[model samples]
Target: MASSNVTSFSHSTFVLIGIPGLEAAHVWIAFPLCSIYIITLLGNATILFIIKTEPSLHAPMYIFLSILAVIDLLLSTSTMPKMLTLLWFDSTVISFNACLVQMFLIHSLSAIESTILLAMAFDRFVAICHPLRHASILTNPLTAKITLMAVIRGALFFVPLPLLIKRLPFCRKNILTHSYCVHQDVMKLACGDTTPNIVYGLMAILMVMGVDSLLIFLSYVLILRAVLKLASRERLKAFNTCVSHLCAVLIFYIPLIGLSVIHRFGNRLAPTAHIIMGNVYLFVPPVLNPIVYGAKTKQIRRRIVRIRTEQKGKITGIYKNKQMIKW
Candidate 1:
């Protein structure tokens, strides 16, 4: 096995095919992808900025959101630049080490994002279910601990994946299906026995995503029970706080689960279908998370409106000054 593995090693570097079967349209696709990347960066940054400057928004929920914003920034940054490069400059060659690093960041950040969402759910649960003790329960130190745990859990779990891939020798199949590297995609290209990779990969997903999803569901179920007992008006008001989170959850998990299922079971689908789903999974959440939260949350919406109003007033005052000088 060792001799065969050594003899079959053919690729010292990996090539990322931006989108399989869409080589001709790479340039055209870059336009919208670039737009989305810009939106993701600006939106998440704005969220972080607002949450930081506004003391009124410094509660546990907003703190978790700010943490989430940071995660989204990292998550999108990991892939969008290289993807745009592949689309525009047509430079597809990536070193082995760089590919592993990208893979680690992408997968681990995703897992971290999932964990953050779970943390957000718990915040909601405390606020709505135990309104009296919300402040006491989700203290600053506890929140920090939760955030740290999420980061450490995500980082440690996926750290071994790239190592596992490093042991396998590629046999001339260096082209990746998407713009970024993923464990499953990279592992499939190896010529060596991948049972360990497959088993560990499944175990990691089940432990992180699987357990998180289940706990989030359980949290919401309890929240629903608590919410139903409130007066009609109070019930609406209470549930409104959860809307942004639910939207965030759906946008993040639906695409993620869809991508995974398609990869495992939808082998009959076109490469384009797989590629499109991959883009949606990676791109849509960052672009939409800030928008959803800013629009849906009353405080964020008010702050944004006030900022716009203040800026408009300043611009008008400047125009009046210019007119006075002309007169």
Candidate 2:
């Protein structure tokens, strides 16, 4: 009788876990998150457009920036919309399959972004530290190949996570806290032992985020050493070129690390910290990347200005021609 009661309770708990929160906080959270999503989408889209249309921005650096923008846009889209809906309309329901899909996309895009940042670091190292070899080394074909490999690696790394989650026997307690369908949050609701899920999750963190960050660090170290060997003015110039990338890397990785730490060791603090860090991690890079790479880079800025100017001229020409036709 006790065993049957236990099983029944488990099933009931599972059904209730994902129901939307009732407080005003849900609406509050949803509004700001929705705003951020809009800003992130527009910012990243603009960056992609500017890079695509501008011939002067066709270097390896801008190519990598475009890739990063693409990754950010997808990443934001994967998690933010559902979160907004959940917050605003009290729709906390996600089907098991839908949750797994969301988790896969979130992880895949995050992994891809990390790898692209590493690639961007390599581009900087070559351009500043080895200017003569930059073109030869990062040829169009090679750049395309590298981008392809990054996407492939990201997908391969995260492929198992969703599979593992889907395989879990979710007897009950499916309520996911916070906002979106994160792996850890979803796993917390599993009725069966989640040892394998936890292990796989940790392994992914160790391999993808850990390894990619390490390689990026090494790339910077080599760049610094090479820059130091140059004349003082040249060294300063080389270092200056890295400032934006460095800022972007810090903005991206720091909050991610903080969120991970909070999720792992600080459960009590996870709710507030997770939401804050989650927003930062998701939206900051998308908003800042364009400013860092586009606003700060001379060539990119000039191209943006030129594009805007040409667009304005076309609009003006069309308006004038329409008026003349009317007259």
Candidate 3:
């Protein structure tokens, strides 16, 4: 009986509502999201291919880039598929278990991505501040260890969340206002007082994201100081290298912080605001990462062009050889 009641409540709350502005806004959101998704996949895949095929890009920076590409892929995958499904099918009825799983994956990936960015910052700091020690400090073993720790830490940090959600007794209202299963959005449906969930959520955000951001900021501060003391050319070069990454960080973090604030407080803005920001946070980095790196890093651009040219030449030569054989 209890299970039946919970199911009924969940079903009633999970009904889909088409956007307020209707077809125009729907088309606006869908078109850009689809375009961004395609570009992001192509860009990230190209970066991954370059890193794998070109030995020159096997350094710490590109290794981090490869990792970032993978994270971006996962991050986009976590939300976009369901979102696109909702847009296409106009169905938003996610089961409670499904919602919990989505929430877990989203938060876990978010934490992992933030931690990886901090690791990247530390990599930059080492490269700039102690150039001689760059190779030794960011060795393959160390990089693998850091990557492992990021995954493990992110998983462990968010493991309790789904567990807590499962244990909660659902109230009469189980409908999540937003399209997806955000932690706070789901917590709002609990029958009992949600003080514990709120506390845990805030603490997790503070400890995981807050601390990681602080460390990254400090690392960059030291890097800035180190850059100032260097030759003007080197200083400029360092700044250029960091600019793309800085832009990416801002685009990612700003919306996330905004989401946190809106969720914690009340949602004064339109519901579409939440949906738009969610899409932005998920899709922007994947789309921009390739463009940034390809534009900023001349070496990568050269290698990509070279790779394509070589492929074309090989195809031409094969055709010519076939013609000569036939003749």
On TM-score, the candidate that comes out on top is: 1
In order of listing, the candidates' clash counts read 0, 6, 0
Clashes of 3: 0
Q: Which is superior by lDDT, 1 or 2?
A: 1
Between candidates 2 and 3, the one scoring higher on lDDT is 3
Candidate 1: worst 10 consecutive residues by lDDT?
A: 1-10
Best lDDT among the predictions, by candidate number? 1
Clash-forming residue pairs, model 1: none
Order by lDDT, highest first:
1, 3, 2
What tens digits encode model 2's per-residue C-alpha lDDT throughout 1-327?
012333443332322121233355677766666777787787778888888888877988888888888888888887777767666665656666777787788888888888888888999888877789999999999889989998999899888987887777776535555566678877886778789989988998889889989988999999989998999988888898888788888978998898788778887763555666766776677777777776677777787788789999999999999999999
Off by over 4 Å in 1: 1-10
Model-by-model lDDT, in order?
0.90, 0.77, 0.78
Which digits, one per residue and each the tens of the lDDT, describe model 1 over residues 1-327? 012332343456677777766678989999999999999999999899899989999998999899889988998898899989888998787788988999999889989989999999999999999999999999999999999999999999999999999998777456777778899989989889999999999999999999999999999999999999999999999999999999999998999899999989988998888889999999999999999999998889898998899999999999999999999
Candidate 3 lDDT over 93-132, as tens digits, reads: 6777777788898888889888888888888889888889
Clashing pairs in 3: none
Candidate 3 regions exceeding 4 Å error are 1-8, 11-18, 23-28, 311-327
